[model samples]
Target: MNRTNKLSVIGIAVFTGVAIMGDAMLSIVLPIYWSDMGLTAVWQVGVLLSINRFVRLPINPLVGFFYRHYSLRLGISIAMGLAIVSTFSYGIFSQFSILVMMRIVWGIAWSLLRLGGFLSIIQLTSKTDRGQFIGLYNGVWGIGSLIGMLVGGLLIAETSIRFITTLFGLIGCVTFPFVPFLTPSGKKEPTVQKTTTDQQKPLLALDQFVLTLSTSMVMGLLIFGVFSNTLSARIDQSYQDNWTFMSFAFTSTAIAGIIQAVRWGWAPFLAPFIGKYLDHTKHKQQALICFLLSLSALFALIGSINQISFVIVLLLLFQFVSTGFVTTTDTIASDLAEKGDSIKVITFHTIMVDTGAALGPLLAFGLLEYFPLRVVYLIASILLFVLAIGWISWLRKKQNDPFAFSVRK
Candidate 1:
């Protein structure tokens, strides 16, 4: 990538990191501090947490439409503004209705930032290094997750919710001056252009998008949707909030926060390397299969293990598999988008990913109501194994036809 493109990618990643810290912190703080936030009902906590996602289900397509006509710079600016308002009010608002409205605003802000970020990468990066750049972008922005989970989760015990949310909101204000410098100013031109040979090749069957889009949804369902939402409870089941290290007592929530923080902390270095490998590898399908199978086994191992130390180690390894799952699956989506109408394809890809994420917790929680957590994880493992088997079939078919138009550029 050129210097300007590189700078833009880094700047937007930084901006997104800040924008997400407020949302990320809520995953850790909201349920525990609902009363502190003036919430009177327990069920209301789930509404507050999930309402943003429901709003995004309808808003992503609109944001995609917005990018087609408007500048990413403008979209990101508006998103940041909404994020600031919502995050700041998290500390100030006590009324449930007003809080829900702010959550809805945050939902819209997230859609803009997400689509805007991916659109920026699609605009700025060429095919040769697209994976690496997008991978790095994911890693850099994850710093906000690290901060949100680590600092915010740990600090809730020492400070007030209002203090934490307000502090994060103010930190977002510091990035206002840098927004325009990072995002592209003009509307997006078409990024997909088939080569002469590619033009001659028949397009991949099933709309050329179904495979990757479906895969993206499943991975998101497992990683962002299920694992993230249920991590604290999983730790609690294993450690019972009594695990200690080096004479320091740790609550399950604290342990869960630290574990998630550790993942994000390593993501900046780890995700980029994974992306760079995917960029260079010629056998991308094989790589995807390996990632899926690895995840399947890890899920099984996590479900069966009862030793807290071993489970923590297994969970950490599961994190590695998950990071690879998301990076690999998303890079496939980006690659596929580059082969067609970039915005429309990516918009659908985003929706599918959001769908998986949205459904994961509901499904997991509902199942948890009847089955053990191990049963839930094993079910996920079985789904992943089936996905891997399906991909193996796809690889064989692709080998039989050299000219079949696959999603990759």
Candidate 2:
């Protein structure tokens, strides 16, 4: 990538990273503080948490269609405005209905930001270096989530949700000036294939797209959706109040935030290395399977453990595994998108992410209503392991038939 394109990537990543602070903080905050926030039922927390992602299901494709005519600047401006307003509303509103409305607005804003970000990054880079840049973008943008959760979790004890959210919203306004300079021109690069590699053609194949989309969806569901929503709550279940670790005081909320924060804190460095590994590896498929399988084992182990000392360690370990999966899965999706129609493929990618994310809280909370947290983790572990096996089987089948993917132009 040229210096200009590289700057564009960094700009979009920072802008997006900043914009995500409010939403990311709320993952732990809302679940932990449902009663304090004027919620009457625990389930309402899940609903509020997920509603934005649910709305993104419809909103993402529309953003894709909108991009055919509009520029990233316009979409970004509208998105930033909405992000500010909605972030403020999280602090300002007590009524469930009003909060729901703001979350929907946020969903739309995120669609614009997310779809726009994906386009900018994909358009700005090529296959060889795509993984690293995607990793870099994800890493850079994740800093906002880190700070949002880390600081918000720390402050929520002393400050109100309104205070934290409103402050983050105000902070988002600072990124507005960089939008134009950072955004891509939304032009398509000519589809280039260095070789007649199967990676290019099969990405659009019915089975391949489904597998990739499924992997994307499941990762979102597990990491983005389930783990984040449940992190605090799952820990809190061991005690009615605070959890003590290492002779230092810890609330489940604080600990959850810290765990997530640490993950994203290292993301700027580790994520790119993971992406670089994918770039250099000859066996990307096997790497992805290993990530999936690792997560499955980690989930079961974390869920099964009752010891305070081990639980935190496992939880932190799980975050590292989740990061690897998230980086790998997203890189895979971007590769698929780069090979096909950028707009359409990316929209599909975003929808799957939104779907998993949307379902995450609802499923996590709802399942907790009847099942133990262990059961939930067990179920997710089984699902992941099954998915991994499916991938292995798919790859083997594809290998047996060299023409599994069409070579036609």
**Candidate closest to the true structure, highest TM-score:** 1
Using all chains and alpha carbons, the TM-scores for the candidates as numbered come to: 0.94, 0.87
Number of the top lDDT candidate? 1
Q: Report the lDDT of model 1 for residue 357.
A: 85
The parts of candidate 1 lying over 4 Å away from their true place are 191-208, 245-247, 401-409
Overall local distance difference test of candidate 1: 0.85
TM-score (C-alpha) between model 2 and the true structure:
0.87
Where does candidate 2 have its weakest 10-residue lDDT segment? 400-409
Across residues 248-364, which tens digit of lDDT does each residue of candidate 2 receive?
787776677678778988999988899888877656677889999999999999888787678888888888877788888888888878766777888898899889987887798
lDDT of each: 0.85, 0.82
lDDT comparing candidate 2 with the true structure: 0.82
Flag clash pairs in model 2.
91-162
Residue 242 miss distance in model 2 (angstroms): 7.0
Cα error, candidate 1, residue 261 (Å)? 1.0
